[model samples]
Target: MKNVVITGTSRGIGFELAKMFAKNDCRVLALSRNTKPLDDFNHKNITTISVDLSLAEDIKKAVSFVNSNWKKVDILVNNAGKLINKPFTELTSEDFLEVYKINVFAVAELTKNLIPFLQKESHVVTVSSMGGIQGSMKFPGLAAYSSAKGAVITLSELLAEEYKEQQIAFNVLALGAVQTEMLEEAFPGYKAPLSATEMADYIYNFALTGNKFYNGKVLQVSSSTP
Candidate 1:
């Protein structure tokens, strides 16, 4: 069974993704700030960890878990993200930093620490947003959120190149609006075409096999104009 580590697993896509992988016989380490939801499910293949990705110590705890238990991670899904809906003029430096801490810096730090455990054919998938794509539709009040998402896409591309010789693959999925809590928070009452479970299903499959066909690439997983 492939060992998988998924972040933001308390709810939405991450929660569903965790169950999907576990049901498929993959060993999963599910991390989030709240572990209750996942812990209650208590699937034999799923292990829940309380992790606030913004903190270096929490990240270290995750790394230590992997080092002590799995030793190797077949898939690392950087699925955790933070979004702040504030107009540009109203946005603060701290706002930008808070978003980047979770969406960009945490991804870099976690992936960097996990590199040694990722061997040939290992895949690292970082979840991004359509708003992050340059020249794509830009939304107001998402300056920090969207920019941070874009930063992670570039970070993934660079890592894919740096690890090419090791046969490890890194890819980014720039997703459009999904009916997730995060989406609702950013755009209240804005109905999305896909559901969280639907998106998670797509991500689950892609994380498993997309590396064979592409690496250092960003796949825009959107069916809508937004």
Candidate 2:
């Protein structure tokens, strides 16, 4: 079984992806901000690390530790994300930078650091948002989140071209409003607009089987939109 590393596994798609990989007998290395994620089943083949994505030193240490232990990672899933709802006029420079630091910079840096240790035929899946691709006009208070995710897609496109020679596939999953803890954390009292499990399963398959026809793709998914 191949080994996989998934980031942002404290919750949401990262958590589910880690479980899916372990279920298939893959050695799943999961890194999140939380040292012990609440949903962690503590499976034998799954290893969990807690490191802050926004800190370069912490990320370096985490990468060094994983490389030392696992040797080669067959899959890298960038799935940790958050949302902040503030009007543009109310947003600060620090706030904008913080969003990009977690959503784009950290993801790119981790992917770059793991490039040498990634297997020859390994693939990378970037979990982005439809807001990144088409923009989120319906949501007025999400400019920072939307802009950061947009940068993610652009970064993926460039990496897809650059890494194709090494047989490292880069693909983006653009999702529309999955029901995650962050959704509730940021929007309390709001009913979810969609299913998180369905989105997670869709992403699981996308990472496992999508490389066949997806040389470079911005794959989008929504319960309402095809």
- Give the Cα lDDT of each candidate: 0.96, 0.80
Global lDDT of model 1:
0.96
Model 1 residue 109 CA deviation (Å) reads 0.5
lDDT of candidate 2 over 171-199, digit per residue (tens): 99887766787766545666666766667
In candidate 2, what residue range of length 10 has the lowest lDDT sum? 217-226
Model 1 stretches astray by more than 4 angstroms: none
lDDT of 1 by residue, 114-182 (tens): 999999999999999999999999989999999999999999999999999999999999999899999
**Segments of candidate 2 deviating more than 4 angstroms:** 38-40, 135-138, 185-190
Give the backbone clash total of model 1: 0
Task: Give me the displacement of residue 74 in model 1, in angstroms.
Answer: 0.2
TM-score of 1: 0.99
